[model samples]
Every structure is written in structure tokens, then in C-alpha cells.
Target: MTKQPESSVARPHPGALALGVLGELLITAGLVLALFVGYSLWWTDLVADARAERAGDRLRRAWAAPAAAPPGQAAPAPTYRPGADGIGFLHVPAMGRDYSVLIRLGTGSEVLDGGVAGVYREPYRAAMPWDASGNFALAAHRDGHGAKFHDLDEVGRGAAVVVETRDHWYVYRVDGTLPRASKFDTGIIAPVPEGSGYPGPGRYITLTTCTPVYSSRFRMAVWGSLVRVDPVDARRTPPPELRTS
Candidate 1:
């Protein structure tokens, strides 16, 4: 019998070929997802921290240089105005002796994603620490972008939460905490901050963040009452609360 061409090499079954392609695609997708997570959780933080540090330094420099009133006019009282850079710093000794983050005007990503706490401007305008009476509500990411409020859970009742501005330090004593609340619960950031256990209106501070770490399915809040306001002396000394052992 004439030698027939060696039987054509057996081809892979279509099903097998499809499965091989599927496996490669899955592996690629997994690698891409991991890279994204790393970027979101790590790289973003580095960038945000650098930005925050630069902004904070600029703010301190501005504070150090005061404009003198011309022609012997009386110096006007310093007003709290938030410029594009930021407003001030937030210090929670309960978090750490050196734990502080810059604070800006709005809770939008543009502010918080830059590794800073953001004041609420929707539903209700957040009261500045300088405001006579209202909630100085603030929010920050708990798991990424510097995670400024990552240790918020450590702040218990009686803990101090201090807001440092150019002229003063507004100290607040933690009053209560809501570990879990609906993300849509605007009441948690209201002027009086509902569910905060406060009997009525007062100079309060509400710190809000996403719950359950690495997820944003819910929200958490820490409420505090104004304990005191310390004037920033020429030396810019920190308050006793910040002096941790």
C-alpha cells in the first residue's frame, strides 16, 4: 500500500483550545485587578501624602508671615477662609501623638483623595471650629488615600479631637460613636448630628468615614463636644492633650 501521508497531526479539540484561551484571559484579568488594587491602596496614598505635606508646609509658611497693616491702622481680626490649598490641620492624639491631617472645605474626592479631611458642604454646611455654634462635620477615607481616619475607631468617649488653625486650636472631647450607619444618613453630619446622643445644639465635631475597612458599604461616626479653644501662642505650642507619653 502506498505510504499515505503520515496521518495529519492530531489537532487540539476546539473545546480544549477554548478552555486554554479562557485560562489565559482569567490570569490576565486577575493580574490587572491586583495591580489596580495595589495602585488604589498604595500608590495613591504616596501621591496624596506628598501633596498633603507640600500643602501643609505652604499653609504654615503663610501663617508664619503676617501682613502688617499699612499706615498704622489697627490689625484686623483673623478670619477663617479656606483657600484652594486647605484650611488647617486635624489632630487626634488618640490616633497618635503625631497623627494629623490637613483639612479642606468639601468632602468631594478632590479634597479627601488628596490625603486630607474634608468639611461637609452639602445637606448642611459644616461649621468651622471658629463658628459660634454648629457641628464641624468632617469626613475622610478610612482605607486609602492616606486613610486619615483609619484609626477613628480608637477614639473613644473622652478622647480629644483637636482642630489646629493658624490662630487657635479647637479641642473637642469625644462624646459618642456610631459604628455602623447607612451611608445615606445625612443626619449623622447635620448641624446637631442626629444619633450622636447630644441633647441639643452645641459646638460639636462629627468625624465620618466608611465602615468595615476596605469597603464603603456603610458609614461610621464619632461625635465630640467642644472642650476648649487654645490660642496659638507666638511659639505655636501644642495643647496638653497632644502631649502623649
Candidate 2:
């Protein structure tokens, strides 16, 4: 065989193999993480955009009066007609009525039932919008999957949140943010400021949500005051957003 020329056989290098595997794993993990992060970002953005579109739709539907109501049928009011069960619409330009919401006074977050909503009665109502002398407080969940109030955090101190009824929209502007509040914190519960001697005046709106990103050991409350409550001129409806990128 003429000394077979050292049998030029190639053997796998252990170091290269290990490095290859690690590189593959790292690449896979990187891809997965990239996908997750992208999904999360897009999810939130989509939610915000969809809600904005729905808000505009609500305004349009509110504006459109049934040209003569099929001749015999009477036209219904702009507000979603109260169902036979009696639950009507809760309109907020930021969020549509599709999310069931109720404004209960004495009831607390526990009553919110993981659903999308806002409160108009009691503790929250006493001080919010109605209680010119105190902070009108409200709370809703920032749904991760559905995006109910996900954009709420984006609402700047100057941004306006409108709460509309069958008749009109009640607008409030962000005035302050409560990073965290202790258990049974009266200030967080009441419309007045904490540690203040007397009942604080200044009509305000307080919004409560969970804190520390995912955990709920404490409450994050954002407070604002009613600047105005204007009639929703459905006729002056803004343009529709049919699609989003």
C-alpha cells in the first residue's frame, strides 16, 4: 500500500463541537427572546391602536342617526340602548363599551373582577370629578393580553381621559401619580391627600392600578382633576382608523 500517506482521516474536534452547540443554543435562545420581545411590544402597540380605532368607531356610531328608523321604528338614542337586562354602555373614547364597566361607590378593586371598567359612585365618585373638593378616583386593569388600559401608563399628566355617558363625555387631566400606597391608606382610598389635616379641596380624579410591573403587593394610583365635561358632539366625529401597522 506504499505507507498509506498517514491515512488522512479527519476527526471531529471536541472544542469546535462544543462551541458549535453552544453557538446554536445561543442563537436559538436569542431568536426566541427576540420573538417574545417583539410580540410583547407589538401586542401592546396593537392594543393601543385598536382601542383608539374603537373609540373613533364609537363616536361614529354615536353620531350616525338611523336616517328615519325604518319608517315605523323610532330611532334610539346615541348611547347604546339599555338591554332588556338593563346594562347600558360605558363609553370612554380611550376604551370602548365592549369591555363591561361599572362605577360602584363603596365597592373596591376586588369587585372589579379582572374585567375592564371604571367606577363612578362612592369613594371614587365622592372625590373624583363630582367632588370638586377632592380627587375623583377610578381604577381599571392594564390587561397584558387584551390591552384594556395598557396605554394608561402612557397617559401623561396633561393627557385627558374622557368618561362618556349616554349623554356626554366627562374629561379629566392627569395631575399626579401615586407610585405606591400602603394597605388601607385612607389617602389612596379617599379623595383627600394623605397626612393632610383637613379634607383637601380641588376636584380630582384618581386612577389605581397594580405596581412593580407584574406583582401587586402595592397599588399604583394616578390622580387627576376634572377640567371639563363636554357634550360629545358625535357630529364632529374624527376620521376612522380602519387599519394599523
TM-score winner among the candidates? 1
List the candidate 2 regions with Cα displacement exceeding 4 Å: 51-161, 179-203, 208-220, 232-245
Q: What is the C-alpha lDDT of each candidate?
A: 0.90, 0.51
Cα RMSD of predicted structure 1: 2.1
Candidate 2 lDDT over 1-245, as tens digits, reads 57766667798899999999999999999999989877755565465446544544554464454444657787653322211111222333333323334343333443333233445354344443433376555655554433345445555556555554444456666666667676456566475656323245666666666665645577666666666666645453311211123
Candidate 2 at 166: error in angstroms?
3.4
TM-score of 1: 0.92
> Judged by lDDT, which candidate is best?
1
Estimate the TM-score of every prediction.
0.92, 0.50
Residue lDDT tens for model 1, 86-115:
688999988887999998888888788989
Which residue pairs collide in model 1, if any?
none
